[model samples]
Target chain A: MSGNPVERLGRGTTDLVVDLGGLARFAGRVVVAGSGRPWRLRRLLDEVFGIGVLSISIIGLSGLVVGLVLGLQGYNTLVRFGAENSLGAVVGLTLIRELGPVLTALLVAGRAGSAIAAEIGSMVVTEQLDGLRMMSVDPEDFVVAPKAMAMVISMPLLSALFITLGLFGGMVVAVGIVGGDAGIYLTSLESSVEFREDVLGSLVKALVFGVLVALIATWRGYTAEPNAAGVSAATTSTVVASSVSVLIFDFFITALWRV
Target chain B: MNVSPLRDLLVGCFVLAGLLSLAYLSVTLGGLSYRGPGGLQIHATFDEVGGLKPRAPVVIGGVKVGQIKSIQLDGDLRPRAVLDVDPAVGIPVDSSASILTSGVLGDQYIGIELGAEEDVLKGGDEIQYTQSAVILERLIGKVVQNLGADSE
Candidate 1:
């Protein structure tokens, strides 16, 4: 606290590097523990129920709303150039390739990501994790692995649902509301999107985001200080860090996909 | 976290919905269909394909019957396109396959002009009359040249 500016900057850099290394190690541990015998199907299912099933309403509603807005906006813009027929392609491609996975990840990071961090952080503060350790139950296997594994399993499914609902919403606006030909809308949408590129790429992106968000949330909670303030800080950090990493990783994934 | 039958049921439903949505996205919207060996496969060689791409629709009278299976080069080094046409559409052997743009700036597709021949095209048959894509710049240049000739 009393160090000069240069010393403080140096110390901060060291802490950042150390924290990154720690996070990576924690992620490896979770993967190893998750992949081990017995599979812990029950614990994983409970977490999936908490994380994936519970977040569906928010994800589905947001997807539909986003699609509606895209349809409205795309129609207005494309109509100027007499390209309103391509509105379906525009909305579909945008949602499938970019918005669907990214938005779902961000929403999940906010909803389930924060929940995971808070729950695990509070457990840390309350010495529940320690109690599990005392009982010779590796906390990583009993708790962390299931949560992390559930996030991975849930992400792509939730993303697919988001894209589907978004497409329906777009159709409702483009065909039902905007007076566009339903056949033309659907044809354009189907023709424009490719299976290998758009759909697979989207699932891959969602999967990557799932891994990142899960690792960040769990790692933050596991490494939090054993106090109430630490739990709060861990929860906040999980949200902020998960969101920023999702966006950054999204850019890289997109660039790599093109390659 | 304790596992309950109710919770398992809800999770099952969620997983099912998610998978159904994924299927819809992949099969319906993404156009991942079964490429059975059922269609009438025909070949057409073009001088220049322009912006024509694989999987572009093969249409007759503005109705899509099938699509372009693949675009490759022939022995003559020209762009040869394999078209997967519907078997029921008894297109004459003398029909021509022309690469046409959908709109002013839309995707390029193959348009078939049916001939008055009695014999229908079969699998692996070559389309004798094939028209290459209309390059916009070439069209503009021709117009500009025609105007110059008129002035002279």
Candidate 2:
């Protein structure tokens, strides 16, 4: 049993190294493929529509609800300290700095990242990817590149929508419900939010999360075993990996880029 | 796959709207403006700036009339702040500049108290009367010293 445990540990380490190497090679190939003349704009738009536009309602609604909740809770706490006037600053900073990008990325990972993995996994299981290879069409370029580019373009835009709607939701709760002055809330928000720090940081986070979700989803799908169960597993793994990584990277990014 | 131009157009509009709103929010909420309301540069020297940062608002009667463009040390090693005030706001020659904390324990900004004078200060003019930032620890120490002296 002791020998078996040691061997399993060694095998796990080796698997991790091999997986990292595969991911690096896949990233390299995607970079090398580059955006050539036949820019595949149509395919890219289709992916953007599927990934960004379709996810808007879900992202926007969640942002609104979350903002309202933050305002409600913040008002209750701040009133105790007679600082209720700062509700806008609290809500705006939280949404802009942390919640907006992180929540949007998670939603996109669940909705679009899983879809990417499942679609590619299905292609792999059905041997469609192999068929493309037989036709001398590089599968990464034809299948993955456009989707990845769409994600990179769509994430920051979606995050901006989330933040904008979230601010309105916060205003509704803080001003309409909590009896705070709208002018004070707005002025405080304006004074507190910094463009170079909060806005730029949020966009940067969204961009990184977008690239990560696409890469992980595509890698899992591309390497999926040739079976129906493998496709489902790939979809599940995409959601899990993308969500966890977004959270982990958010912490590091916040620490590193703190104003 | 059938490419729908209508769908693409709608998506493009949605993205463009989002981006425009983002730009608006960053500019308005972030208090970022490029054209500085056509201002004139003025200077004030303070013994200490404390927690004051560059770009801090310059307020008069609680209204933001300008901003601190930069802070540098003069030959005497005293910190001097360069303020850019709206040309519409004419500061009298005897006006005083003071560094003040916003709220109870908030960020520091420059506050200007207008003085009555016949002559109005122009661009490149330096305000003579100035006050430095009040350090909280120093205030507490003074309070403690007063209490000790009373007990003695």
Residues B11-49 of candidate 1 have per-residue lDDT tens digits of 999999999999898888766663467888999999999
RMSD of 2: 3.5
- Candidate 2 per-residue lDDT, tens place, A16-121, comes to 9999899999988876664665677788888888888888899889989988999999899999998888888999999999999999999999999999999999
Tell me, by DockQ, which candidate is best: 1
Task: Give RMSD to native, each candidate.
Answer: 3.0, 3.5
Best-matching candidate per TM-score: 1
Report the lDDT tens digits of candidate 1 across residue range A163-189. Answer: 988988999998789888878889899
